[model samples]
Target: MTDPGAYPNPGQHPTPHEQPPRTRRRRWPWLVIGVPVLLFGACGVAVVTSVAGGNDTTVTPGPAAGDTDGGAPDRGPDFPGKLDHDTAAAAGATITRDELAYTVSPLEAVDTVLGSYLCSTVTIDNVGTTQNDFNGYTDWSLQDTGGAIRDATFGPDRPMLNSGQIAPGGRATGSVCFDDRTGATPGTYVVLFEDTFSLSTDRLAWINAL
Candidate 1:
């Protein structure tokens, strides 16, 4: 307190501990800064994000590239072949084409079955010793309710048919399909078997579907 002329002899700068007070910082500088700019940028980003989301929703339209057009699929060719016959005969021979003779068991149906279309089959026997040589015929004819005469055609083929192997007196039945009428309908069918060797014909059976 008594040092009149005793200032530190030379110019020594103030020590760090005795530095001057700092100027007061203004808080409004932050408010005046880029806050509005940042908010505007955020709004722009949100708009862009929404637009991108909408585009993502419509990324691909309709079906994928390999989608089927729902049109008719390709149909392969129809089968061109004959039917399989139950040729579980004595010899393990499968009867095919003209050589085939088919049969159905005798089935007695009621009036309703007779009135509708049906398939009638009967047993065909192989009676002869040797296998059949040429063709033999079993002619079938029908008399309907209206007195109309219809050929109970063989194999639904042309008139009388040829069978390759109906051994000598062999018997094999062929299918004759037609509607059997009710008793009131009045119908008749006769099956007659004929071969070249036999002058006499063999009458297999007569049936009335009605």
Candidate 2:
């Protein structure tokens, strides 16, 4: 039998040097994921707003060709030096100029072209004592207002101006025709008659504007 005081000793109680079990702190992982997700969502909203704002602008186009005058017909003055067919020869006395004589009939439009065909009578008078050879075609060209030259083409229906020589104090006459279907615009066109086809002298006789 043991003593009661010795069996249950008070020295067995917790001392000041011993400590209770400490609770470990729980780590909060949601803060790390929530910050990155919020930043990415803000950037996504900004990109969508920028793309939606760009689609509201408008664009325009330019005009087509030949719209310089708003598709309107060219309205200008008639060509000069026009004469009646029957009165052309009778009026020669008044039509005669310095050296050569010319009578241009009014421009005639056979097709959509304003002045498609032009007929004229060219008379060369040898004023000098020597004989003069009057050349044609190569010495003649139709010059437009834009400084473009139109050459001649001989067809079954198209007649070329007769070219020949004239004696002293004598005269020669021939028919002149111009077809402006090709390379012709709505503007003034003049007949240029060069004395010589060579480059030596570019002596020209303008037959007025049409």
Give me the candidate number with maximum lDDT.
2
State the lDDT at 185 in candidate 2.
57
List candidate 1 segments past 4 Å from native: 1-118, 133-138, 145-148, 154-162, 166-174, 178-188, 191-198
RMSD of each: 31.4, 29.0
Candidate 1 C-alpha lDDT tens digits along 15-107:
898988899988987987779989999998886664442111110112111233475221111111211211111111112212324333332
Give per-residue CA lDDT, model 2, range 1-210, as digits (tens).
Answer: 878876656668756668777898766677788889999999988877644532221111111111226744221122333221111112122233233444333333333324455444555666656776666566555555676666643322434456777777887665555666654456556554544532223223233434
Q: TM-score for candidate 1, please give it.
A: 0.29
What's the lDDT for candidate 2?
Answer: 0.46
Give residue 49's error in model 1 in angstroms.
99
Candidate 2: list runs displaced more than 4 Å: 1-116, 155-160, 182-186, 197-199
lDDT of 1 at 87: 13
Cα lDDT, all candidates: 0.37, 0.46
lDDT of candidate 1 at residue 147, scale 0 to 100:
53
Name the 10 consecutive residues with the lowest summed lDDT in model 1: 56-65
